[model samples]
Structures are given as structure tokens and as C-alpha cells.
Target chain A: MSKTKNFAVVLSAVVLVCCGALILGQKVNAAGEGKITGTVKLDGTAPHMKGIDMGKDPFCSKAHATDPGKMETYVVGSGGGLENVVLYITEGLTGPAASQTATTEPVFDQKNCMYTPHVLALDVDQKFKVTTSDQTTHNIHPLPNPMTGNIPWNQSQPPGAAPVEKSWKAPEVIPVQCNIHPWMHGWFVVVKGPYATSDSNGAYTINNVPPGSYTVTAWHEAAGTQTQKVTVAAGGSGSANFTFKAK
Target chain B: MQRNNLRKWSSVFGAAAVVAFAMPSSAQQTKYDFETRMNIESHVGNITGHAKDAKPDYRRYCVGCHGELGDGNGENFPWVDPKPRNFQLGVFKCRSTPTGTLPTDQDLFDSIGRGFDRSNMPQWSTFTKQERTDLVAWVKHFSPRWVGEKPGTPITIPPEPEVTPERIKAGREVFARVQCWKCHGVLGQGDGPSAATLTDDLGRPIAPFNFAEGARPKCGDTDKDIYRIFMTGLDGTPMPSFADNIKPDEAWDLVFYLRTLMSQHSKEKAMAKQLGLKPVDPNAPAGQQ
Candidate 1:
């Protein structure tokens, strides 16, 4: 009877220890997580955006009967806040965080003879989808910098065609254009590690970074690139702001 | 009697000459001069007018083969072999520069003047130089690739080495060594065992170039053009760069050998025609005239 009681008591103690260890491990992982937040602002007057002429394709022109499309090269907002600025950590991240893959595919859509998002960012090797929702045909030609080791591709998608899924093998800032429409242009900013594009308010956040000191970079297509040094404490956040001179 | 015969023949010749001289000169002159004048006027107009406004010329000449959207699926596509070039994709097979680069304006001009040797695309040499230039510019507008991209600089071609019998024999050895006959048939007819399985980078089935047809090669048909293709294999297709494998002199030899193949094919075709053998049209329905 004594032996049986002792066995039950020992088993309960082991279970309690295992539970404690598991909780402790999770707590430690949570504690090390940090985020980088920042805003990108233009320092001067915003340039006048030019309106697009969709006269070539009747379908595109009819689609934008109510609201005409304009050049999205520079999207400025209140307080000179900039949009389409990509912010990413260029240094101080290692292992899985540095080479992490995105679970969801980033969608790039072509509608009304224009790329929906003028600027897009994705992790290296993450699959992205290209879809067209226009009656007219569109040719997607992405010209990557040869030095980036990414092979360039040009494909044509006619109306009602299946979506094209592709990925970049290396980090690059590829310029995509539609051969059918000379004015249709966009950028595919592929990068390694955590990255985010600034919203209309010019604010961005790159979360779940391991606690450390790092160099963050903000890249605007028209205004060039700016970098800042930041440090994050355990279970806390870091801040990095960038200001660009209007061109 | 001989003198009388000569006199009779001379009189007949004189009468024939008079008849020829009396023929309506204005009608023939007007037809010929009007065509020349129109050609000159269109050429000059193209130079002054903006290239973006060249739609009329494009519609008149290129739309029948290149399509309204430059998709190479025009009304004549069914009748054309090797198909017309699709500009929307922006993948030009013929270029003096490396693969994946745009051909120079001069290259396009030369192509327009020379035309493809075997293809349905006829030489537009009758068009004034300025008109051809305008056509090139209009064609370029079909693709947005020219918006921000600069054309690739042409590769430097070395001076041609002397061609000799021994050199051609060496080229034949190189051809066999490289297994050129695998994709291109032994006679360069594009009918090798592997020709059926070739696909491009986009997974679309593509055929090997038929050299014996003497058609407009995706690359130019000049010796230098052939050499360039041999050195820098076409990208996006099954062709690969042999710059690393073949020596420069050997490439020239291969070019000479290819020229011979084309000439031999031309000779056989001529001989067959002389023998009254009608050439079979591939597009014609089987078992019918």
C-alpha cells in the first residue's frame, strides 16, 4: 500500500515539473520578441501628380468613367506623410527570422489598365500571385537588376486567363510594366527578413523581431533610400523615423 | 534575193519600233511616277509627324500580319509558317546584343529592308528610309519595355577569318561533336527526335529553327548574325550559349557550314522546280488540290 502511494505521488510531481518548464519556455520566447515602428515623411511640397490617359483602351477608359486614374509615383498625405515607402531591417537578424517565409501569398492585381498597388514588397522566395481583372490583355514584364541573381520574366495574360504564381530567388527591386500599356508601371521590392510598407499615414511596423540592435532602411522609389540605427529592449519596441526631401 | 529579205526584215523592225514609241506613255508614266511620289511624301511625313500618331501606317501595312495589338495573331497567321513575331512579349530572337536585350534601331531597319528570307514577312525596301524608321518607332510603342529601358549596346564582332575547305571540314566535326543534329535534324530541317519536346521558359512548346528553309532567322541571316547566335544562345528558349564551349574560329566555320546548308537547300529546290515538280504547300488540306 505504501509503494502504491509513493508511485502516485512521484508521477504527479513529474507532471507538475513538465508543465512548469513548458510555460517557462513559452514565456522566454514571448519576452524576446520585439517590434520596429516608424513613419516616413516628405520634407517639402508634394509634386503635382499627372492624370493618366486611358484613351487607347476603351475598356479601361469605361472602367474609370467616374474616377480617373492618376500617376502614383508619389503619394503624399496630411503632414507630408508618404505612402508606398518600404521599411525593412537590413542587419542584426539571424537564423529563421532572417530567412523566414511568408505563409500567405502576396497578391498583385491588374485592373483598369493599372497595377492596383503601385508598389509591392515581399520576402525572397515567397510565392506571389499576379491576376488581371480587365477585359483587355495585359503583359507583365518584370525587369530585375541583373546583379540581383533573379531571372527576369515577361508574360502575357489575356482576359479570363488563370492567375500567374511566381517567386523571386534573390532580393531585388524589380520594375514591372505592361507592354500593352506604356504608362502602366510598378515595383516589386523583394527583400530578406522582416519588412513593411508605410500606410497612407506614412506609418509602418515590423513585428516579432528578436530583441537586438539593428539597422532599419526606408526606401522610396522617387526619393531614394534612408537608413536609421535602432535598438529594441526585451518584450518592447523600437522606433525609427525617416524624412525625405521632395523631388 | 538576200538583200530583198534583209530589207523586208529591216522594214518590219522599224514598224515594230514605231508601234512601241506610239504606246500611251502618260498612263505608264503616271502610274510609276505617282507611286514614287507617294513613297517620298510618306517618308517625309513620317519624319515630321510624331511617332505616336503612326497608327494609320501600322494599320495599313502591319496589322495584316502583326495584328492590331502586335500579338502576332493577325488574319494571315494561319497561312504563315514559323509565325509572326509577337511584340507584346518583348522577346526578340534576333539581336546583335546578348540575349534578353532589345535590338538596336539599326538592326530593326536592316531587318525591314532585308526581310526574312524564308518567311512571309516581305522586304519593305520600297518604303522610304524615313518610313521604315517611323514603323520601327510605332512598333516599339506596342511594348512598354522602351519606356525607361535603354537598348543594349551591340556586341563587338571580330573581323572575319578566311574560309577554306579545311576549316569547313573542321566545322563539320564540331557540329557532330556538339550534337547539333539532335535538336536540328542532320539536314538542319528542325525535325530531330527532340524537336517535338522543346518548350520555352513559359512552358509553351517551341520548335527548333529550320535552317534549311532559308527563312528569316530570328537572329539576322548575315554571317556575323549567325556567329552572334552561335556565341550567345537565345535566352528563354531551348538554345543555350556556346561561348564557353566553342572557340571563335570554330564559330565562323560553323557559320560557313550553315551557309552551305542553306545554299544546298536552295539548289535542290531550284532543281526540283526545273524538273516540273510542284512544291507541296504544307497549309493545303491533305488529299486535295
Candidate 2:
């Protein structure tokens, strides 16, 4: 009778320890996983964007139809919010988070003689693809600042051509343009860690940020860069807002 | 024993299948096709008149000489003299632009429209304005050097001074002072004393500009082109810039003299053609054959 009682106690202890370990493992996995969310706003009235002259290419002119394509240098949103601002953790990232590889390849598409995304952000060493959907041929040229250590490249993609896949070895803010179509321009803001571009609503969220104090930088093509410091708690959230004044 | 044999066969078949599947995927792995493929699907339902009827078809005219990839190693490369311009290197011999910079769109258009004299490149002036524009745009895709590079601003040419006998005489002196005869022989036949030893930056044997053949100068035959070449020398070759060494007026004189050399060569060639005789190679010495 005593032996049976001891066996029951031992089994219960074993079950309790196993259950505790499983729960602890789940908690450990969730630790240091936080998100940074914010809005990028414009402090002043947005500048009037100049109309693009697509007369050089008939295909481009026809694509826009009646409406003239305007310069996308500044894309302002409702409530004075600025769009396409790249917010990324510029400092204090280490270990796995600093070297994390992006699983999904970021795509930059040229459609209707314009870059679909005026601005795009991706991590360093991540595969980036440039595709053209227009009937007219487009030459995709990315001119990275020589200081960024990323070499500049140019390639032409005809209609029905496969997407050009490439990856940058270092972080850079690359200005992409088509020599054939001067008005067609865009940017590839490559970052080292988690990053996000503000949407039409001017809201952005950078998730999977390891819990730490970091200097988050907000970059706009025209307005330049703004940075802020924020601390993220374990499995918690942080915020860093930015505002740019008209030049 | 039968089971073992069956197992071995099954493994071999599995390996063979894997290899076959892998081969096609590898072949299709290029990010972009070197040759442009027609988009049949996009053009299928062309109820709209907006669809373009004329497209720049490089394959029909250029691929035979310029190569499918524009590397200048086309199928007819062996038969062509002086070879076609290799677009991959982004080095264009004919341009108003300074060295290390791309040519202006107008420069490319002129080359394509006028054609290179004495070479196999035919004048493509028959192409429509739109076709020429499209071709120019298409050719830029051959090199990555065009990316982010602004075309070199053309050097302004002062109006030509009168081309008199005295000007030509001074030009001859200027030419000799610049040692033009070192590569271009005393008669401008491209067989000077140093011609045998001349090499480009890449150590490739380079032929000096043969002025006695009436061939089109690489930078164009215009007075402005000659002046430009004098100011901004050809890059990656033995040509050195005379911008600092020579005055503008002296450069004009040199141009006048070079023109005379070209005209003299053309006159000789015309005479030979009229006589139905093989034109003599001025570079070759007598009694050499």
C-alpha cells in the first residue's frame, strides 16, 4: 500500500514539472518580442507637386489618360500626415535580431510607366525584385550613394520579361530611376533590422523588435531624416512619432 | 536477393527523376532573359486602337552584327573588320561626351542615323522617328554604366577660323608638335614608327586612327567633333588630352590639316575605283607582297 502511494506522488510530481517547463518555454519564446508603432506627420502645408510631362513616351501619356501624372516627392495624407516615411531601428539592436534574414523577397514593380511604390524598405542582404508590367520597355537603374557600400546597377526589362532579382550587401537608401523615362523615379530604403514605411494613413508598425532602448530613425526622401529614442518592455509595445516641416 | 535488387532499382530511378527535374529549373533560373520575348497574351485582345502597331525590332536588323546581348560578338563577328561596338563595356568610340561619361541621346541618334563610314554598320535613317527613339532607349539597356550618370556636357566650339593655306601650314606644324606622326605616319597612313608598339590600357594592340583611308573619325567628321576630341581625349586608349597643351586656335588649325589628309585619301580611292584597280593599302610598303 505504501509503495503504491509513493508511486502516485512521484507520477504527479513528474506531470507537474513537465507542465511547468512547457509553460516556461512558451513564456521564454515570447520574451523580448515587442513592436514599435507610430505616425509620421507633416508640420506645415504640403508643397504642390509639379505635373510630370509624359509626352516623351506615348505609352506613358496614354496610361495616365486624362489626368497628368504628378511628382511623388511628397505624398501627404489627411490630417497633415506624411506617407512613405521609412521608420527603422537605427541603433541598439544586437544578436539574432540584428542579423535576422527576411524570408519574403521585397518586390518593386513598374506598371503604367510609374513605380507602383514610390518608396520601399527592406533589410540588408534581403532579395529584392524589380518587375515591369508595362508594354513599353523600362530600364531599372538603382544609384546607391557610393558611401553606402552598395554598388549601383542598371538593367532593362521589356514587356513579358522576368523580374530582375538582386540583393544589396550593405544598408543604403538607393535612388531608383529609369533613364529611358526620367520622370519615373523611386527609392529603395534598405535597413539592417526591422523597418516599416508609413502608409497612406501615415501609420507604420515595426514588429519583432527585441525588447531594448533604441534610436528609431524616420526618413523621407525630401524632408530628410528625424530620429527619436524609445524603450520597449518585454512582450510590450513602444511608440516613436515624427513630424517634418516644409522646406 | 530479388527484394534487394528491387530496392536498388527504385533508388536509382528516384535519383534519375530528381536530376531530370533539377536540370530544367537550373536552365530557367536567370532573373531576366537576355533576348526579349514577345508578349502574345498582352497583344491578343487588341480591340483598342491605342495599342502600338510598330515596335523596335532589334532582332531583325542589329542582332546579326551587334549580337543578341550587344556584346559585339555576333555570328558575323569573324567576317566584320574592326569589329562592332561592344555595348557591354559601355565604351562608345563615337561621342561628344567626355571620357568616363555616357553620350547624350542626340549623340547616339546621330551615330545610328548616319552610320559609321567604312564599317559594316548601315545607315538606319529609314527608321521612323519613334523607331529611332525606341532603338536608342533599347541600346542603353546593354550597359549598367548609364545608371545615374549624366551625359557629359558638350564642349562649346568657337566658330571655325578661315581655312586658308597659311592656317593649314600652321596646323601641320601644330600636328608635328603634338607628335601626331608617331602613330600616324608622316603621310597620316597610320603606320608611324611607334604604330607597331602601340597598345591600349588593356594591353590590346590598338591601331592608330588611319586618316589616309577617308574613314569617318570615331568622334564624328565635323569640325566641332575634332575640336572636342582635341580637348577631351579618348579614354582607355593611347590618346591623351591636348586641352592644356594646345591653344584653341591651334586646335582649329590641326582640324583643317586632318581634313586635307582625309580628302587626299578619298581622292586617291576614287581614282583607284574609277580605274577598276585594287586600292593600295598605304600602310603596306612597296615590294612587301
Candidate 3:
């Protein structure tokens, strides 16, 4: 009996050592992490973003009375920099960098009857929070293509409501809208690997990308997608800039 | 020897070719792969339902509206207002579970028997309990979600409390706080300020339920069902779950207030009449009413 037990103990040690080595091997491959950084700009004159009429909801109208909410379909910053474009590695990402799901939760906020950030880029299976900061009621409904394996859901966030935490199972560009406020619209750009959304100045940095050649794809809501190829060296950075023609 | 080896290889290749041709490509396969899901079973108490057992019943009844692939694209698709549910997506409006999760076997069982009110679906209570249980498994087999995911844990509903004038009034306060009137209207008239703009998951124009219309809710209209509706929410619609905001005790109070709004006579309505409970003041500052 003790001999059998000893055999079992030895077997487990072997299995543990093998599993640890496999995990450490993957970590070693994931070392020398680099990043991809770039700016996305509009090539032509930006379209006119119509001002929203929040007259339906008194609270929404009052909150934005002074500033006045405008459409976010095309938020072109100074120097024709396009905002809200998501950049992600569509190819060449492998091992831990490719399979790792982001643990940090991103917040998609509804404030003053408009979705904050306008476009939220997320890693597939990464948890995110939906929060409401307005006095009025808003339903956060993300409609994803059922074929993509990401199911659609509608949840209401009233004033002072607790945050709803959720995550997507697959990569899809889901259109989120509030049924109560038809003018409210946003996008949840879910991607498989490392991703970043273009900031106010159209700048983005996809961190923790182990050094490798990659095909980075930039996706815009209305302007469509563009791909660029780049290579990164150990402990260094790669850059890919994109310019989308405005409609 | 070379000739024998060639003959053996040819036979192997021939069998492989036959197998390949027998399997239908995904694009050409319009029917659901029922063979893989025939083993799916549903349990409602002691009743154990086999998906295989419901095929004949589904063909005779449900297939007319639910479709051959259970995609809700049956021949009756063009005639319906709010279209029949596409079981393939697995997202349902009636669920005891929270939003974004599969409904429990019992929830689906109840939905089949209760049917949807004011919609094309008629109550299928005529079917035996065993038949309905089998049908629940059949409904689930259409979605890959059943194979990959489990039904969400059903939300907890506290025991019913005695309805009083104060409880009814407190329910009104709960209604005001959540601003249910934004789409449901102050008097539950389905003509709230935001009602005109409301749409379902499909982007089709959908009207909020008018409690005064004398029509039963799409989900069941029982007291427990009403509590579950607001708590779990009608997914794929404008109605949201108040489970996060409304306490379990207060949920019962709101349920009673909603009872008063309904055209149907109820004990709560009789009590509200005696108490002179008025419609919530939508214009009242947040909690001042």
C-alpha cells in the first residue's frame, strides 16, 4: 500500500513539474514584451455631426443645455485626427499574448444621455462594466450578431442604479443603443488579442505585445477597416498609422 | 505485393471519399443537426423529457410557427406582429433567470403552457405535462447555447406580504424612483414620454405594456410572474430588471401597485380605491413625492 502511495506521489510530482515547465515555457516566450503605437487621421473634410435633440427627456436636455450634445459618428479632432478607431492585431499574435484575456475591467458609462467614449474596444472574454451617471433612465442594449457566438442582451440602468458587469464570449462589433433614447448609440468593438481605442487625439498604444511581426487592423464605425503590416524587435516598439477618408 | 498495397490504399481512399460526401457542408445544411442534440433532456420535477420524443409533436404543432430549423422563420413569419421567438439565438423574453442567461427548464415549461398574451402564440396547456417537458428539451436543442452554457440561477422571490394602503403607496414610491413611467407612462397607459421611440431587440417599433388595456402581459400575469418580470426583466426588450435596485420586500409592494393599474379586478385594486392612491407624480423631484 505504501509502495503504491509512493508511486502515486512520484507520479504527481512528475505531472506537476511537467505542467510548471509548460507554463514557464510559455511565459519565457512571452518575455521581452513590446508595444504597437500609432495615430489614425481623417484624410478629408470631416462630416457635420448633427446636434441631438434631447427634448424628450427633460433631465437629458437640462444636463446638456449649455454644452449641447452632438452626434459622435465622426469625432475629428484638431489636425484631422479621427477618434474612437480601434486598433488590434489580426494576425501574428501567438501564445500567451494571443490567448490571455484582459483582467482589468473597462467602464462604459452613460452620462447626460450619451455614451461616454462613444466607442469601447475590448478584448474577447474581458470583463467590462456598464454604469449610468445620469438622473434619467437608460437601457444598455448591445446587439451582436448571433452567428458570432456573442448573444445580445438589454439591461436598464436607472438613476443611482448599481453597475452591471458583463463580458463577451467572442469577437464582434456590437452596436449598443438605448431604446428609450433613440439618439443614444455606441459601439463595443470586441477583438481577440491585444487592442486599444484611438484617444481624443487619435493616438493608440497596444501594450504587452511580445516582439513579432503583425498585421494590425484599424476599425472605424462608419469608415470601415484598414490593415497595415509592421514588425517589432525585442524590447522595442512597432508603429502603424492609418488615414481613413471621411464620407 | 505492390499491386496488393495499391488495392488496399484505393479501398481506404474510397471509404474516405464516401464519408466526405455523406456529410453536408455548413452552408448547404439548412436543417438543424438534430442527431447531435437528440440526447438533450429536460427535467421539470420528476418528469424527465427526451428531445427525441418531441419530434412528432413539434412537427405537428410548433414547426408551423417555430420553423424547420427552429429559427422562427416558419411559413407564418410574414403574418406575425411581434415575430415568433428564434430559438436558435437562445435569448428569451420570459425568464426567472437574470438577463443574458438561458431560462431554466421550468421557466420554458411554464412559458409553453402559458403562451404569450396579445401575440400569435396561443396557450398550449392542452398538451400533457410530459409532452410539454419533452417540448422544452426540443426547444433547447435548437440553440448551441444549451450545449455550452447552463441556465442562470433563478432569482430569489420572497414570500408575499399582506397588501395595505401604506404598502401600495410605497409601491408607488418605488415606481417613481425607478422612473418606470418614462416608457410605461404615469398611469401605465403605454404612452409615456419615451414610449414613442421604444423598439425591441430587432429594431422594430414596440409599444410598452398598457396595464389599463385589459390584456394579459406577454409573460404570465400572476402575482409571482409580475414580480419575476420586473426583477428578471424581459430580455431583448426595453423593460429592464430592477433586481439590482429594488429590494426583494419592495418588489412585492411594487407588484401590488402595478395590480391597481391593471384593468382586471384584484384585491390590491379594491384596497387602492379605498386608500385613494393616485398615479405617481412624474414631475415630482426625484424622491420628494
Best by TM-score: 3
User: DockQ of candidates 1 onward, in order?
Assistant: 0.00, 0.01, 0.24
* DockQ value of candidate 1: 0.00
Query: What are the candidates' C-alpha RMSDs?
Result: 31.2, 23.6, 8.6
Candidate 1 residue spans exceeding 4 A from truth: A1-31, B1-289
| Tens digits of lDDT, candidate 1, B115-145 | 8656787888988776787777666665545
Q: Which candidate has the highest DockQ of all?
A: 3
The second chain of candidate 1 has a TM-score of 0.65
Q: Model 1: how many Å of interface RMSD?
A: 42.4
Tens-digit lDDT track of model 2 for A1-247 = 5565555456545545544433353343356689999899998889999998776556688998887899999999999889999999989986446656566787899988889899989888899888878866565667664324454444545455578788876788888776456678899989988899999879999988878999999999999999999899888989988989987
lDDT of 2: 0.69
| Whole-model lDDT per candidate | 0.69, 0.69, 0.87
- B229: Cα error in model 1, Å: 17
Q: How well does candidate 3 reproduce the true complex, by DockQ?
A: 0.24
lDDT leader: 3
For model 2, how does the per-residue alpha-carbon lDDT over B119-188 read when each residue is reduced to its tens digit? 7988889986556656666666666545534567865667888666666666666665555655676667
Model 3 agreement with the true structure over A41-101: per-residue lDDT tens digits? 9999999999999998899999998999999999989898899999999999864466667
For candidate 3, write residues B130-182 as lDDT tens digits: 99999999999988888757899999888999888899999999999988899
